[model samples]
Target: MILTTHILSGAALGANIPNPYAVAGLSIVLHFLQDTLPHGDYLNKKSRLREFWKVAVDLAIGLSLVTAIVFYKNWLSDEVFLTNISTGIFFSLFPDFTTFLYRYLNMKFLRPIKDFHEGLHCYENGSRRREFRIENGFWDIFITLASLLFLLFLCAG
Candidate 1:
Protein backbone atom coordinates (compact mmCIF):
# COMPACT_ATOMS: atom_id res chain seq x y z
CA MET A 1 0.00 0.00 0.00
CA ILE A 2 1.02 3.60 -0.40
CA LEU A 3 2.51 5.31 2.62
CA THR A 4 -0.43 7.68 2.86
CA THR A 5 -2.89 4.82 3.22
CA HIS A 6 -0.72 3.08 5.76
CA ILE A 7 -0.26 6.24 7.77
CA LEU A 8 -3.93 7.11 7.89
CA SER A 9 -4.94 3.55 8.75
CA GLY A 10 -2.28 3.34 11.44
CA ALA A 11 -3.30 6.68 12.87
CA ALA A 12 -6.90 5.55 13.00
CA LEU A 13 -5.91 2.39 14.83
CA GLY A 14 -3.71 4.43 17.14
CA ALA A 15 -6.51 6.82 18.00
CA ASN A 16 -8.79 4.00 19.09
CA ILE A 17 -6.32 1.51 20.58
CA PRO A 18 -5.50 3.64 23.67
CA ASN A 19 -2.52 1.55 24.83
CA PRO A 20 0.78 2.69 23.36
CA TYR A 21 2.56 -0.65 23.41
CA ALA A 22 -0.39 -2.49 21.95
CA VAL A 23 -0.84 0.15 19.32
CA ALA A 24 2.79 -0.17 18.28
CA GLY A 25 2.69 -3.94 18.11
CA LEU A 26 -0.59 -3.98 16.26
CA SER A 27 0.59 -1.33 13.85
CA ILE A 28 3.49 -3.52 12.79
CA VAL A 29 1.20 -6.49 12.37
CA LEU A 30 -1.27 -4.34 10.50
CA HIS A 31 1.42 -3.26 8.07
CA PHE A 32 2.02 -6.83 6.98
CA LEU A 33 -1.68 -7.60 6.90
CA GLN A 34 -2.37 -4.59 4.74
CA ASP A 35 0.38 -5.59 2.34
CA THR A 36 -1.41 -8.86 1.73
CA LEU A 37 -4.45 -6.94 0.56
CA PRO A 38 -4.76 -5.53 -2.96
CA HIS A 39 -3.24 -2.08 -2.77
CA GLY A 40 -1.10 0.22 -4.88
CA ASP A 41 2.61 0.89 -4.62
CA TYR A 42 4.72 3.24 -6.73
CA LEU A 43 7.91 1.21 -6.66
CA ASN A 44 9.12 0.34 -10.13
CA LYS A 45 10.86 -2.90 -11.04
CA LYS A 46 13.02 -1.33 -13.77
CA SER A 47 14.61 1.68 -12.18
CA ARG A 48 15.84 2.07 -8.61
CA LEU A 49 16.28 5.80 -9.14
CA ARG A 50 12.68 6.17 -10.21
CA GLU A 51 11.55 4.07 -7.28
CA PHE A 52 13.51 6.25 -4.89
CA TRP A 53 11.97 9.44 -6.24
CA LYS A 54 8.50 7.92 -6.10
CA VAL A 55 9.01 6.74 -2.55
CA ALA A 56 10.47 10.09 -1.50
CA VAL A 57 7.49 11.93 -2.87
CA ASP A 58 5.07 9.47 -1.31
CA LEU A 59 6.71 9.66 2.10
CA ALA A 60 6.84 13.45 1.99
CA ILE A 61 3.13 13.63 1.20
CA GLY A 62 2.24 11.02 3.80
CA LEU A 63 4.19 12.81 6.52
CA SER A 64 2.66 16.11 5.56
CA LEU A 65 -0.85 14.65 5.68
CA VAL A 66 -0.20 13.15 9.10
CA THR A 67 1.28 16.40 10.38
CA ALA A 68 -1.74 18.33 9.19
CA ILE A 69 -4.03 15.87 10.91
CA VAL A 70 -2.08 16.14 14.15
CA PHE A 71 -2.33 19.90 14.13
CA TYR A 72 -5.96 19.97 13.14
CA LYS A 73 -6.85 17.53 15.86
CA ASN A 74 -4.63 19.18 18.47
CA TRP A 75 -3.38 15.70 19.42
CA LEU A 76 0.03 16.91 20.58
CA SER A 77 -1.36 18.37 23.78
CA ASP A 78 -2.73 15.02 24.90
CA GLU A 79 0.12 12.79 26.04
CA VAL A 80 -1.74 9.55 25.44
CA PHE A 81 -3.01 10.65 22.06
CA LEU A 82 0.40 11.81 20.98
CA THR A 83 2.20 8.68 22.09
CA ASN A 84 -0.22 6.18 20.60
CA ILE A 85 -0.58 8.00 17.28
CA SER A 86 3.14 8.59 16.79
CA THR A 87 4.05 5.07 17.79
CA GLY A 88 1.49 3.70 15.36
CA ILE A 89 2.80 5.83 12.51
CA PHE A 90 6.40 4.84 13.19
CA PHE A 91 5.84 1.12 13.57
CA SER A 92 3.56 0.93 10.56
CA LEU A 93 6.24 2.51 8.37
CA PHE A 94 9.12 0.65 10.03
CA PRO A 95 8.85 -2.54 7.97
CA ASP A 96 9.13 -0.76 4.63
CA PHE A 97 11.94 1.46 5.88
CA THR A 98 13.81 -1.58 7.12
CA THR A 99 13.27 -3.33 3.81
CA PHE A 100 14.77 -0.38 1.96
CA LEU A 101 17.83 -0.41 4.22
CA TYR A 102 18.26 -4.13 3.78
CA ARG A 103 18.05 -3.85 0.01
CA TYR A 104 20.47 -0.92 -0.34
CA LEU A 105 22.77 -1.36 2.68
CA ASN A 106 22.85 -5.17 2.56
CA MET A 107 22.18 -5.45 6.27
CA LYS A 108 22.63 -9.09 7.26
CA PHE A 109 20.64 -8.65 10.45
CA LEU A 110 17.56 -7.56 8.56
CA ARG A 111 17.57 -10.60 6.30
CA PRO A 112 15.01 -12.43 8.37
CA ILE A 113 12.69 -9.43 8.29
CA LYS A 114 13.19 -9.02 4.56
CA ASP A 115 12.42 -12.68 3.99
CA PHE A 116 9.28 -12.53 6.09
CA HIS A 117 8.07 -9.41 4.32
CA GLU A 118 8.57 -11.00 0.93
CA GLY A 119 6.68 -14.05 2.07
CA LEU A 120 3.77 -11.88 3.15
CA HIS A 121 3.39 -10.14 -0.17
CA CYS A 122 0.58 -11.21 -2.50
CA TYR A 123 2.73 -12.07 -5.51
CA GLU A 124 5.23 -14.23 -3.69
CA ASN A 125 4.97 -17.61 -5.36
CA GLY A 126 7.36 -20.52 -4.78
CA SER A 127 10.12 -19.12 -6.98
CA ARG A 128 8.69 -16.00 -8.58
CA ARG A 129 8.10 -12.58 -7.08
CA ARG A 130 6.23 -9.67 -8.63
CA GLU A 131 6.79 -5.98 -8.44
CA PHE A 132 4.25 -3.85 -6.63
CA ARG A 133 2.03 -1.94 -9.03
CA ILE A 134 -0.24 1.11 -9.06
CA GLU A 135 -3.20 -0.72 -10.62
CA ASN A 136 -4.95 -0.38 -7.28
CA GLY A 137 -4.06 3.24 -6.72
CA PHE A 138 -7.70 4.25 -6.68
CA TRP A 139 -8.39 1.79 -3.87
CA ASP A 140 -5.44 3.20 -1.97
CA ILE A 141 -6.82 6.69 -2.22
CA PHE A 142 -10.32 5.61 -1.21
CA ILE A 143 -9.11 3.68 1.78
CA THR A 144 -6.83 6.47 2.92
CA LEU A 145 -9.56 9.07 2.75
CA ALA A 146 -12.11 6.84 4.45
CA SER A 147 -9.72 5.96 7.25
CA LEU A 148 -8.75 9.58 7.80
CA LEU A 149 -12.35 10.70 7.88
CA PHE A 150 -13.23 8.00 10.36
CA LEU A 151 -10.32 8.97 12.57
CA LEU A 152 -11.39 12.57 12.47
CA PHE A 153 -14.91 11.64 13.52
CA LEU A 154 -13.56 9.53 16.34
CA CYS A 155 -11.36 12.33 17.56
CA ALA A 156 -14.16 14.85 17.43
CA GLY A 157 -16.48 12.67 19.42
Candidate 2:
Protein backbone atom coordinates (compact mmCIF):
# COMPACT_ATOMS: atom_id res chain seq x y z
CA MET A 1 0.00 0.00 0.00
CA ILE A 2 2.90 2.32 0.71
CA LEU A 3 3.95 1.57 -2.84
CA THR A 4 0.54 2.59 -4.16
CA THR A 5 0.57 5.79 -2.09
CA HIS A 6 4.07 6.54 -3.27
CA ILE A 7 2.77 6.61 -6.82
CA LEU A 8 0.17 9.24 -5.89
CA SER A 9 2.57 11.22 -3.76
CA GLY A 10 4.19 11.88 -7.09
CA ALA A 11 0.97 13.74 -7.91
CA ALA A 12 1.70 16.41 -5.30
CA LEU A 13 4.99 17.01 -7.05
CA GLY A 14 3.06 17.28 -10.31
CA ALA A 15 1.57 20.61 -9.21
CA ASN A 16 -1.42 19.02 -7.52
CA ILE A 17 -2.20 19.54 -3.84
CA PRO A 18 -3.87 16.40 -2.56
CA ASN A 19 -4.03 13.20 -4.54
CA PRO A 20 -6.93 10.78 -4.09
CA TYR A 21 -4.83 7.74 -4.85
CA ALA A 22 -2.31 8.87 -2.25
CA VAL A 23 -5.03 9.47 0.30
CA ALA A 24 -6.73 6.12 -0.22
CA GLY A 25 -3.45 4.26 -0.31
CA LEU A 26 -2.24 5.87 2.88
CA SER A 27 -5.57 5.26 4.61
CA ILE A 28 -5.65 1.61 3.64
CA VAL A 29 -2.05 1.05 4.67
CA LEU A 30 -2.49 2.66 8.05
CA HIS A 31 -5.81 0.97 8.76
CA PHE A 32 -4.66 -2.46 7.65
CA LEU A 33 -1.36 -2.22 9.47
CA GLN A 34 -2.95 -1.03 12.69
CA ASP A 35 -5.56 -3.77 12.53
CA THR A 36 -3.06 -6.53 11.79
CA LEU A 37 -0.28 -5.60 14.21
CA PRO A 38 -0.47 -7.81 17.25
CA HIS A 39 -1.43 -5.89 20.35
CA GLY A 40 -2.75 -6.92 23.70
CA ASP A 41 -6.41 -7.83 23.41
CA TYR A 42 -6.90 -6.48 26.86
CA LEU A 43 -7.21 -2.71 26.97
CA ASN A 44 -9.33 -0.20 28.76
CA LYS A 45 -12.20 1.35 26.83
CA LYS A 46 -10.55 4.73 26.81
CA SER A 47 -7.28 3.35 25.50
CA ARG A 48 -8.94 1.34 22.72
CA LEU A 49 -11.11 4.29 21.82
CA ARG A 50 -8.11 6.56 21.72
CA GLU A 51 -6.23 4.19 19.48
CA PHE A 52 -9.18 4.02 17.11
CA TRP A 53 -9.48 7.81 17.01
CA LYS A 54 -5.77 8.21 16.35
CA VAL A 55 -5.95 6.06 13.25
CA ALA A 56 -9.18 7.71 12.19
CA VAL A 57 -7.65 11.15 12.45
CA ASP A 58 -4.66 10.10 10.39
CA LEU A 59 -6.98 8.85 7.66
CA ALA A 60 -9.06 12.03 7.73
CA ILE A 61 -5.98 14.20 7.42
CA GLY A 62 -4.72 12.29 4.43
CA LEU A 63 -8.08 12.52 2.73
CA SER A 64 -8.37 16.20 3.60
CA LEU A 65 -4.96 16.92 2.17
CA VAL A 66 -6.11 15.35 -1.06
CA THR A 67 -9.22 17.52 -1.09
CA ALA A 68 -7.23 20.58 -0.23
CA ILE A 69 -4.87 19.94 -3.11
CA VAL A 70 -7.63 19.40 -5.62
CA PHE A 71 -9.52 22.53 -4.67
CA TYR A 72 -6.59 24.80 -3.98
CA LYS A 73 -4.80 23.92 -7.19
CA ASN A 74 -7.96 23.76 -9.29
CA TRP A 75 -6.77 20.27 -10.18
CA LEU A 76 -9.94 19.75 -12.17
CA SER A 77 -8.51 22.09 -14.77
CA ASP A 78 -7.65 20.59 -18.15
CA GLU A 79 -4.06 20.24 -16.98
CA VAL A 80 -5.09 17.63 -14.41
CA PHE A 81 -6.05 14.08 -15.26
CA LEU A 82 -9.09 14.07 -12.99
CA THR A 83 -10.96 16.92 -14.59
CA ASN A 84 -14.48 15.55 -14.22
CA ILE A 85 -16.65 14.15 -11.49
CA SER A 86 -16.44 10.68 -12.97
CA THR A 87 -12.67 10.82 -13.08
CA GLY A 88 -12.64 11.95 -9.47
CA ILE A 89 -14.92 9.08 -8.52
CA PHE A 90 -12.75 6.61 -10.39
CA PHE A 91 -9.61 7.69 -8.55
CA SER A 92 -11.37 7.42 -5.21
CA LEU A 93 -12.74 3.97 -6.04
CA PHE A 94 -9.62 2.48 -7.62
CA PRO A 95 -7.70 1.51 -4.49
CA ASP A 96 -10.74 0.14 -2.70
CA PHE A 97 -11.60 -2.11 -5.63
CA THR A 98 -8.05 -3.41 -5.90
CA THR A 99 -7.85 -4.01 -2.18
CA PHE A 100 -11.15 -5.88 -2.20
CA LEU A 101 -9.96 -8.11 -5.02
CA TYR A 102 -6.60 -8.77 -3.38
CA ARG A 103 -8.21 -9.64 -0.05
CA TYR A 104 -10.70 -11.90 -1.80
CA LEU A 105 -7.98 -13.79 -3.62
CA ASN A 106 -5.92 -14.13 -0.46
CA MET A 107 -8.87 -15.59 1.42
CA LYS A 108 -9.99 -17.88 -1.39
CA PHE A 109 -6.69 -19.19 -2.71
CA LEU A 110 -3.64 -18.07 -0.75
CA ARG A 111 -4.97 -19.19 2.63
CA PRO A 112 -5.38 -22.76 1.41
CA ILE A 113 -1.88 -22.81 -0.01
CA LYS A 114 -0.45 -21.46 3.22
CA ASP A 115 -2.46 -23.95 5.29
CA PHE A 116 -1.19 -26.90 3.26
CA HIS A 117 2.38 -25.72 3.72
CA GLU A 118 1.85 -25.13 7.40
CA GLY A 119 0.78 -28.76 7.79
CA LEU A 120 4.14 -29.94 6.47
CA HIS A 121 6.32 -27.59 8.53
CA CYS A 122 7.22 -28.07 12.17
CA TYR A 123 9.61 -26.08 14.38
CA GLU A 124 11.50 -27.82 17.15
CA ASN A 125 12.67 -24.36 18.12
CA GLY A 126 10.50 -21.29 17.74
CA SER A 127 11.40 -19.59 14.50
CA ARG A 128 9.15 -17.84 11.97
CA ARG A 129 11.31 -17.74 8.81
CA ARG A 130 11.41 -21.28 7.49
CA GLU A 131 12.85 -21.77 4.03
CA PHE A 132 10.52 -24.02 2.16
CA ARG A 133 11.20 -26.15 -0.90
CA ILE A 134 11.66 -24.78 -4.41
CA GLU A 135 8.11 -25.83 -5.29
CA ASN A 136 6.70 -23.64 -2.56
CA GLY A 137 8.75 -20.68 -3.72
CA PHE A 138 7.48 -21.23 -7.26
CA TRP A 139 3.90 -21.30 -6.06
CA ASP A 140 4.37 -18.02 -4.22
CA ILE A 141 6.07 -16.36 -7.17
CA PHE A 142 3.44 -17.64 -9.60
CA ILE A 143 0.62 -16.17 -7.54
CA THR A 144 2.28 -12.76 -7.39
CA LEU A 145 3.04 -12.79 -11.11
CA ALA A 146 -0.48 -13.82 -11.97
CA SER A 147 -1.85 -11.06 -9.79
CA LEU A 148 0.34 -8.48 -11.49
CA LEU A 149 -0.76 -9.71 -14.90
CA PHE A 150 -4.38 -9.42 -13.87
CA LEU A 151 -3.85 -5.84 -12.73
CA LEU A 152 -2.14 -4.98 -15.99
CA PHE A 153 -5.05 -6.45 -17.91
CA LEU A 154 -7.49 -4.44 -15.85
CA CYS A 155 -5.57 -1.28 -16.57
CA ALA A 156 -5.47 -2.01 -20.28
CA GLY A 157 -9.22 -2.35 -20.43
Output the number of the lDDT-best candidate.
Answer: 1
Residues 89-124, candidate 2: write the lDDT tens digits.
Answer: 334334434433334444454545334322343321
Error of 2 at 37 (Å): 17
Maximum-TM-score candidate = 1
| Model 1 per-residue lDDT at 120 | 77
Residue pairs clashing, model 1:
none
TM-score of every candidate relative to the true structure: 0.84, 0.28
- Put down candidate 1 lDDT per residue, 118-139, tens digits, no spaces: 7776663332233344555556
Provide the overall lDDT of each model, using Cα atoms, as 2-decimal numbers: 0.76, 0.36
Q: Which 10 consecutive positions of candidate 2 have the poorest summed lDDT?
A: 37-46
Enumerate residue pairs that collide in model 2: 17-69, 18-66, 18-69
